[model samples]
Target: MMTMPSAPQLAVQASVKRADEILVVDDTPASLQLLADLLTEAGYVVRVAPEGAMALHSALARPPELILLDVRMPGMDGYELCRRLKAAPQTCNVPVIFLSALRETTDKLRGFTLGAVDYIGKPYQAEEVLARVRTHIDLHRLKTRLAEEVEQRTEELRLSSEELEEKRAQLQALMGFMHQVREDERTSIARELHDELGQSLTALRIELSWLRKHCAPLGEVVLERADAGYALVEQTVQSLRRISEGLRPGMLDVLGLCAALEHLVSQFAERTGVSCSFSADADDYRLPENGAITVFRLVQEALTNVARHAEASQVSVRLAQEKNSLHLCVSDNGRGFASAQPRQGFGLLGMRERVLLLGGEITIDGKNGTHIDVRLPLVKGE
Candidate 1:
């Protein structure tokens, strides 16, 4: 049994086989033999066809690097054959040089218009023929090599683009999982504070109240001390509630996103003394739990930034649903910073990261005052 050649062996064989093939088409036997001999002596593989039909068949079956065609053949002439060769995808790139007795400019122009590369007068000199043949063959080979390089580069770019897109998707998924874990931790902490610390404080306040009311026999100073203790315990309980709410707002879970946002805006105005207004198209937007929390946190961060950075008198936040998307805009009439300078704080960066994880778009414009606009799709891809 004959063993098949290895891949490396085949590659080596291809590399060593560098001879170019030339096809000569002429009705005259002498002319065909003469050109064939000339090309064969120059270390090229030459194929001779007595007529245009045979030449076309040979070229199509196994394409050659170049063709030396006689213009005045019997049936299918040189111009017609050139047109057919150019029309065929297989032989279209093969260089064709026409041989003719006619030396008129019109004759050469006709040959060129049909896709012939060069014209050789009938009674051509051997030296001129050899020079032109070598030049055209080299040019054709260079063109083919460049085309292959372009195709290879195009394939590399396509693969690179696909890899980049895959990496981006993986990063987004990781960030989203991290956000969910963070939210779960916050909820657990909030629940612990509300149930344990809150109840204990309330019970202590009740005990102090009982002592102040029932123990009248105690001195005035002792009774006053009980009252102060009861008041302090009450204040501590209220502060605990505020802290728990900040961690995970009860309103967001119970009353939905719109109500939670409204309550938040009311508290911000009361605490900051800045005129803050909130408006929505509908009472309840009916969003998924994660989506609702994402929107609420985004707005919360925006308000915090305004209070800290924006020295604005008035702020407006609007929420609306347009078809399949949710739109939110937060604008303030504040002393905006220079647009060219980057934001020094992590607030904006965190907001951008959160939006990208959810496959949303966010734009912050600090032209007149700070303006943050966000658009999110109702349905997100995993």
Candidate 2:
């Protein structure tokens, strides 16, 4: 039967398999061999060089994970080699530790300033050298791993943000398309009602009048009934006209945005018994069909909200054109509510969606009654 390896034995095997590569530089052969042997015993692959020149050449050829350098040598000393290594792009990141006879505070500071990670005395203990080497190697590996992780996470976040922006753009386009379809449907319905229903009611009224006038010696009760029928037909015609206008106002297409808004305000005041005023900077300003409808609908929705929610007597609407943008304001003297809280109704949400589709902005303030301000660019992509 075969026996499985113990935990300690498994650990040793794992460490050997993942052994770190180290470069040892010294002026004396004995010192280089001793350091190499010590590192080799610790499961690290060790490369030895007798002087600074050889060490530099070896490192340039194939850079090691960590470097153990000596201070005093014939041609190029450890300090010079360390400075050169740090300057080189390929070997700049490799950690270097000084193993030298010079143990003075100034010598250590000089080594550190030259970018040496650590300094050790000439009569170095085997255990201390091994411990310091192990510590620096582990630290360098951890730092490298951490840097890679940070870069990867940053890339992921950038991609995610880009994806989110793309999705939002797609959704905005869909909303605009749906809004256009709804407007077209409304226009079609309004045309049908005006042409078909309005004509039928008019014909009915004429027939009733003819019956009342031409009937020979008609009874008073019968004549009275004909008159009542005529009145009902007239009322039905008026109701149908009003409903058709509400679906899509003809003034919006005929007179332009300002005139349509004025008609809307006057009608609201008459119906709701709320005093409403409208003012505009320009009377003859014309907008495209879509723009005219958008402005008209905005005013209509605002006034509707005021009538339903505002318990006040007075309201004001204003419009102005400045440079390449149009500004609109609607305010009322009514009971106020907090604007920062999430809106409970879809009225505000619908308004926001409309403004967004036009690349415009809308703000609502309820601090002093209710005030709504809107700004829209006259030209698309401007």
Best by TM-score: 1
The C-alpha RMSD of each candidate to the native structure, in angstroms, is 6.5, 6.2
Using lDDT as the measure, the top candidate is 1
Q: What is the per-residue lDDT of model 1 for residues 70-184, given as tens digits with 9 covering 90 to 100?
A: 8898899999999999999999999999988888899999999989899999899988999999999999989999999999999999999999999978977887898899999
> What is candidate 1's CA lDDT for residue 278?
96
Candidate 1, lDDT over the whole model: 0.86
The all-Cα superposition gives candidate 2 an RMSD in Å to the true structure of 6.2
Off by over 4 Å in 2: 1-19, 25-31, 48-63, 69-125, 209-224, 284-289, 310-312, 380-382
Per residue, candidate 2 scores C-alpha lDDT tens digits across 117-222 of 9999889999999999989998989988999999999999999999998998999889888889988988899999998888888889889989989753778888
- For candidate 2, report its TM-score: 0.78
- What TM-score fits each model? 0.81, 0.78
